[model samples]
Target chain A: MTGRVIVITSGKGGVGKTTTSANIGTALAKNGASVVLIDTDIGLRNLDLLLGLENRIVYTLVDVVEERCKLKQALVKDKKNPNLCLLAAAQTRDKSAVDADQLKTICEQLQEDFDFVLVDCPAGIEEGFKTAISGASEAIVVTTPEMSAVRDADRIIGLLEAKEEIKSYRLLVNRVRPNLVQTNDMMSVDDVVEILSCDLIGIIPEDTGIITSTNRGEPIVNDENSPAGKAYINVAKRINGEEVPFLDINEPKGFDAFLAKVKTFFGIKG
Target chain B: MELNKRFIVDLSQAKTPADIVFEVSNILENPEAANRKIWLKLGDVSLNQSQILSIKSLISSINSTLSLIESECSQTELAAATLGINTKDVEEELQAELSTLEAESPKDTPSEQYIPLVDYKEEEPKESEHEQQENKEILDENKQQQEEIENKQDEQTTQNTEEQPAVSSDINQEENKKDEEIQNQLDSIFDSEVKLENILADDKDITEMQNWPLTKEAEDDFEIPEEIMTDEDYAILQMNTQYHKQTVRSGQVIQSNGNVVIIGDCHPGCEIHAAGDITVWGVLGGIAHAGCKGNTKAKIRALTLNAIQLRIADSYARRPDHIKNIYVEKSNTFTPEEARFVNGSIVILKVNDR
Candidate 1:
C-alpha cells in the first residue's frame, strides 16, 4: 500500500522536531499502522536515539544510497513494535552526503511497504532541511511558545506553502507553559495558531518528563501518565484522521488548583 | 651550652599550598614558638625552593631556626633539600629517635611507657612496607608472564615459518574454504560492509534477511574464539604509532595510516580511524575504527571503552541499546577494555585478561 509521506520540520533548532517525530511515529505504530521514520539530519541525528534504536541501526540511509547495503537492509526495526522501523542517518557524514533527489527516491521506495513514512528534518533552511522535506507530501511545523520559535515556525510554514509537493501543513505548538499563558507572560496556543494563520494539530504542555525520557532514550509518548504524552497521542490520532479533542492544559492541576481555590475563597483574582 | 627546644608544626592536613602557608603563619603567631627550632611537616603540596625559603624566613621571624622539613611529595622534599634543610620522612626519623632513646635508657627502666609510642609509629610503616613488598611481587609476576607470552609467540612464529614451505600450496585452498564459511555466517551477523560485491552478485532478496532482534540472543551470534595472536597482530605492532595529546571533541575526525594513541577523552560524536590499532589513554566515547584498511587482527583499546561503535576491518558492533546512557558518566574509576576481531565477529576483552 502507498504510504502518506510527512516531513516534521522546524526552522529553529531545539524546537522538539525530533521528539515530535519520534513520539508521533511511535504513537502511530502503537495504533497498528506500519510506520517508518527517516532521519535526514546527518552528522547530528537524534531520532534513532529518541526511539531507543541507536544500537540497532546497523545500516543508515547513506549506506543504502551508496549501495553499500540494500534499502530493506538499512531499515532498523523498532525494539518494542514490530510494525515500526527507522532509517537512521550517518553520524560521521554531513548533509553533503545526501541530496534532495536521492531522499525522494528512497521515500518513494519506502512508501510501497509502510502505511506512513515520517521524515525528521534538521534545523535551518539549509541543504539538510531541503533534503528532508524533499521526500514528504505533508509537513508538521513544530515550535515552542517562545517568540523566536514561533517566528521560525512561521518561516518554515511559508517555505512549506511555497513548495507544491507539501499539499498541507499543520502547526504543533510544543512546550506550552499554561500558567505563564494565564499570567499573559507567554503566548497561548490560540495566539500561535492566529499569528501563523495555520491549522493546529496539537498543543503539548511543557513537561520535565521530556528531559528524563530523552536521556533514557525512550519516547515520551510511551508514558501514559504524562500530559505531553497524552497530547502527543491525541496529535497522532488526529493525524490518523480520528476526531480527537484538544487537551485542557489551561486548567490548574493538583497543588496549583488548591492554591487557585484558596485565592477564589478570599475573593482575590488569581 | 643548653640545647635548643624543638617545636614541630604539622600542617600535613592542609589541602592546598595556600592552606599550608596560612596554617604555618598561624602557628608562628604563638609566643611559645619563639626561641625554638621549628620542624615543619607538609603533605602532598608541592612547594618550590623560593616558597620553602620564604617559609624558612617566616619561621626565623619568631627567632626559631627552621632546622628540618618532612614532606610526602618528592618535589617538596627536593625543594627543602635545595634550601639546605634536612628533609626526612616523619616515620623514619621517629623510628631513628626511638631507637636512640631505647639505647640510652637503662635496662631497669619500665618498657611499658615506650610500647604505645612504638606501636603507633610502627603500624603505618609496617603496613606500607607490606604493601610495597606485595606490589613488587605483582610487578615481578607480570614481567615473568609477559616474558613467557613473548617466548610462546616467538616459538609460534618460528614454527609457522618452518611449516610455510610444506603447506604453502594448501594455504590458498584453505583460505577459499574459510571465506565461503565466513560468507555463510555474515548473514547471521550484521556485517554490512563485508563482501558487498558478492552479496550483490548473489542477488539475494532484501526481504529474505531477517531483522536481528536487539536482545541477548543477538549477542550470542558473535562467537568469541579463543585468544590467539596471529601474524596480523604482529604486523599491527610493527606499525608506527601516532601520539595525540588533546581532547577529541564532537565533529573532529582523527585519521591515521598506522596506530593512533590519544592521550585524552574522545567525546561522543567524534571519529577515530586507524589502519592499525586505536588506543585512547582516556575514555573512548566516540566511534573508533581500528584496522580501517581491512586488517582483521587490529585492536581498539581505551582506559574506558564506552565507544558508540567499534569497527575493526569489515566487522562492526554498535553499543547495545540496553545501555541507555548515551554519554558515559565521567568517572575516575575505569575498567580498561580492548576490542579485537576474533573469528568472524568483534569481541571485547578486559585489557588485564592478557
Candidate 2:
C-alpha cells in the first residue's frame, strides 16, 4: 500500500521536534500501522537513540543513497515493535551526503511497503531541512508557546505553504504549561495558533517525564499515564483520521487547585 | 616478635610420590607460598629418607622450610622423622594453633581466626602491637605447648576408644568444613592474580583463529572495492602517519592517506578516517574508520574506546545501545583499548594486554 509521507520539523532548535516525531511514530506503530521513521538530521542524529535502535543501525540513509548498501539493509527495526522501523542518519557525514532527489526516491520506494513514513527534519531552513521536506506530502510544525518559537514556526509555515509538494501542514504547540498560562507567565496554545493562523493538531503539556524518557531512549507515548503521552496518542489518533477532542489542558486539575488553595491559606501568593 | 606463619599443603588425595611432588610444585608456584613454613599432609603414600630429603629441598628452594609432615603411612612418617621434619598429628596441631590464636585475640570470630592459615602474609603488617606481644608470649611458652599436646593426645585416645564411630564421623565433618574454607580462601587470592592471565589467554586464542578478509573479494553484499595490499604497503602506511594534538570536536572530519593519530578527545559527530591505523590518545567518542582504503590490517586504538561507531576495513560495529553515556566524562584514569577486524567482526581488546 502506498504510504503518506509526513515531515516533523521545527525552524528553531530544541523545540521538541525529535521528541514529537518519536512519540507520534511510536503511537501510530502501536496502533498496528506499519510505520518507518527516517532521521534526516545527518551528523547530529538523535532519532535512533530515541527509538532505542542506535546499536542496531549498521547501514544508514547515506549508505542507501550512495549504493553502499541496499535500502532494506538500512532499515533498523524497533526493539519492542515489529511494526516500527528506523532509517537512521549517518553520524559521520553532513547533509551533503544525500540530496533532496535521493531522499524523495528512497521515500517513494519505502511507500510501497509501509503505511506511514515520518521524516524527522533537522533544525533549520537550510539544505538539510529542504531535503527532509522533499520526501513529505504533509508537515507538522512543532513549536513551544514562546514568542521566538512562534515566530520561527510562522516562517516554517510560510515555507511549507510555498512548497507545492507539502499539500497539508498543521501546528503542534508543545511544552504548554497550563499553570504558567493561567498566571500569564507563558503564552497560551490559542495565542500561538492565532498568531500563526494555523490549525492545531495537538497541545502537549510540559511533563518532566519526557526528560527521563528521552534519556532512557524510550518514547513518552509508551507510558500510558503521562499527560504528554496521552496528548501524543490523541494526535496520532487524529492523524489516523479519527475525530479526537483536544485535552483540557487549560483547566487546572483537582489536585492542583487544592494545592493552590492550601498555598493561599498559608498566606502565600497562589 | 614476628609470628612464624605456617601454610598447609594437603596432598592426602595424591596416591603416588609423583602425584605428591607435582601438587607441591604447583602450590609453590603461587608467590604467596614463598618464604613461609610449609606443613605437608600426605595420605597413604610410602616414601624413603631420600624422597623426603628431595621434597624438603624443593620447599627450601622457594626460601620456605618444611617444618612439619603428617602421614598416615608408617614408612612415610619414619622417613619424615629421620629427615628432622616434625612428624605431628595434623588435627591435634591445628587444635593447638587455634587455641593459641583465640587466646591472644578473644574478639575475633572462628572464621576470622581461621583466615591466618592461608592469609597470614597479607594480614601481617596490619597486626596490632598488643597482638604481637601476645604472639611473643605464646611463642616463648614451649613447656606449655608440650603440656598441651600431651593433654590433647591423652584426651584423643580416650575419646577414640569410648566413642569410636562418633569420633570418626566428627573428624570427617570437620575435615570437609576445613577443606571448603581453604578452598574459598585460595579462590579469593587467585582470582585477582589470574584475571589478567585469563584475559591475555583469550586474546591469544582470538588472534590465533583464522580471520578471512571482508573486502569485496569475500562476496560481501556491501559495495566496498577489493584492494589487495602487500607487505610493502603496510610499511609505507606505518611511515606516513599524521599526528594531531588537539581536541577533535563535533562536525569535524579528519582524513589521512595512511595513519591518523589524535592526542586529544574525539567528540561525538566527528569523523576520523585512515588507510592504516587510527590512534586517539584521549577518549574517542566519534566515528573512527580504519582501513578506509580496504587495508584489512588497519586498527583503531584509543585511551577510552567509547566511539559511537568503529570501522575496520569493510566491517563496522556500533556502540551497544546499553551504553547510555552519549558523553564520555573526562577523567584521569582510562583503560586503553584496541579494536581490530577478526573473523568478519570488530573485536576490541585492552591495550595493556600482549
Candidate 3:
C-alpha cells in the first residue's frame, strides 16, 4: 500500500497534462487508493483548478518543503473524495523553486500516507519539467497522436530512459480521435505505441466532456455518465490491478446502427 | 572506458531476471540489474533505494512490492489512455463499480495506508534534512493558486449536491453537457496506482515493456577472462560488441545508421555512423552517430562545422547556427559556441576565439 509518485509529462505543451493529472488523480482516488496530485508547473499551476479544489488549499508543496507548513498541512483534500489530495504548486515562483532532489524528498514524505502521487508536470523539458519529474518512481509521458507531440514525447521518453532514476517508461496518448486514425489521416494508437516503445497505459478518445469538464474544474471521472469518464474509471481500476478489456471507442457501426437503419422507416439522419 | 546504457521497457514484452519481481531504477542502481534483467513474481516484494537517490522516486514508488501484489491480485483494471509508452488496461466491470467507491474516499486509499509497511519512516528523515529546503523555494509561488483551486472544487461539490437535491439527474445533465470530457480521475490511477500493474513480473515478459533493452546504468562485472584481450594488457580483443563504421564523407554515410569516423568537418546533410566513436578531423556540416548502442559515454569530437544537429546516445542537440550571425557582438567576435551540457541541458557555449 506504499504510495507511488508518477509524473505526467510531454515535452511539448498543450497536450492536456493538467487535465490528465486531475482525471488520473481522481481516477486513482475512485479506486479507493489514497492519492496526491502534485502540480509541479510552479509558476503556471493549474491542477487545483482542474480538480475543482482551488479553495481547500491550506498549504502547498512549497510551504511544506520550506518548513513554512507541515507536509499534511499542504495536502488539499479532494472535495469528492477524502482519499484524494492535491499538493498545489507555487504560482508566484518558477521552476527554480524546486529541484529534482527536493521533489523526491517531498514525494518520499507523501508516500508515507498516500498510495499514489501523480505529478502534473509543466510543459517543456526545462528545470521545471526536471523538477517535476525528479521525485517520481516512474513516468507517465502524456502525448497526443500528432507527430510534433509524439516527437517531443519521444525526446522526453529518451530523457526518462537516460537517467538511472527511470529504468523504463510508459505512454498515455491523450486526445485521440479514433475517427482520424481509422481514416488513416492520423497516427493510430499502434503507431504511437510502436514509436515510443514503452508500456501502453491507456487511450482516451476525443471527448468534449474532457474540455468542458476541465473548464468547470471537475474531473471527468466524477461524471459517471460520460464515456471518457468511464474510460478514466477503467484507468483507475487498471491502476488498482484489475485486468479490464479495452473499450473500443472507435466509431461504432454496430447493431445499434443496424437498428437505426430499421428506424429509418421513422426517419432519422439522412 | 565502459559506456552507460539506457532502455525503454516494453511491459508487453517486459522480461526480468530470475531473482527479482520488479526492476525499478533503484534496482537498476542496484548492483545486480547490469548483468541480469529484472522481473517480478506473484506475491513477491523488493523495493529499496529506488526513491531516495535518483530523480526516479516515482519508479521506486510505483515498482513497490505492494503494487506488485495488487497487480498479481488483479483488484483494479487498466484502460487505454495517454500519449506515450502507455498500454490499454481496462478494469474488470466489477472493479469499475468498486472504483466508484474508491473515488469517494481519498485519504483512506489502500496504497497510502500501506506506507508504513514499506518502511516509509526510514526514508524520510535522512532525506528531509537534506532535500526539503530546496523544494520549498520552488513551489512557494504556485502554492496559493493550487490551494484556492482545491478549496473551490471542494466547495463546488458541496454546493452542487446541497443546492441540487436530485443527484443522479443533475449528474446526467452535467454528463451530457460535458460529454466530451471522458478524461477522468481514473487516469491518475493509471499513472500512479496502475503503472505498477504493467511492471514485467517475469524475465520472458521483459520485452512486453518495450522493444529495446538498454540498461540506464552500465551493466559491468562480466568476469573478463585474463586470456581474452591482454595483448600485453593492451587488450584489443575483437568482440562483436564494438561496431566500427566506415569513414564519413560529404553526403557520405560511412554506414547508414552506422558510426562514421572522420577527423575533419562533415559536409552538410551527410549521414555517418561510428558505432564506436566519431573523430572529425575537419569542419563539415553533417550527422555523426556515437555509441549508438545505448552508450552515453561515447564522445563526439570535431574541429568545427555547421552541422545543425548532433545525435548522441538517444539525445539530439540542435546547433543555434540556424541563424547566420549578421554581425559580431560588442563583446568580441569569436567562433560559434561548442556543444556541452551546462546546468543539465545541452547548449552551445559561445567560446571566445583563441
Off by over 4 Å in 3: A253-270, B1-354
What is every candidate's C-alpha DockQ against the true complex, given to 2 decimals? 0.27, 0.23, 0.01
List ranges where model 2 is wrong by over 4 Å: A251-256, A259-270, B1-239, B294-296, B342-345
Which one wins by lDDT: 2 or 3?
2
Interface RMSD of each: 2.7, 7.5, 22.2
Candidate 2 chain A has its poorest 10 consecutive residues by lDDT at: A50-59
Candidate 1 residue-wise lDDT, A1-270, digit = tens: 999999999899998999999999999999999999999999988887788776556578999889999889888778788899999998878999999999999999999999999999999999999999998999999999889999999888888989999999999999999889998999999999999999999999999999999888889889999999999999999999999889999878789899999999999995
**For candidate 3, what is the DockQ-based docking class?**
incorrect
Weakest ten-residue segment in model 3 chain B by summed lDDT: B190-199
Q: Model 1: which docking level applies?
A: acceptable
Q: What is the lDDT of residue B343 in candidate 1?
A: 52
TM-score to true structure, per model:
0.63, 0.61, 0.42
Alpha-carbon RMSD, candidate 2: 16.0
Order of models, best lDDT first: 1, 2, 3
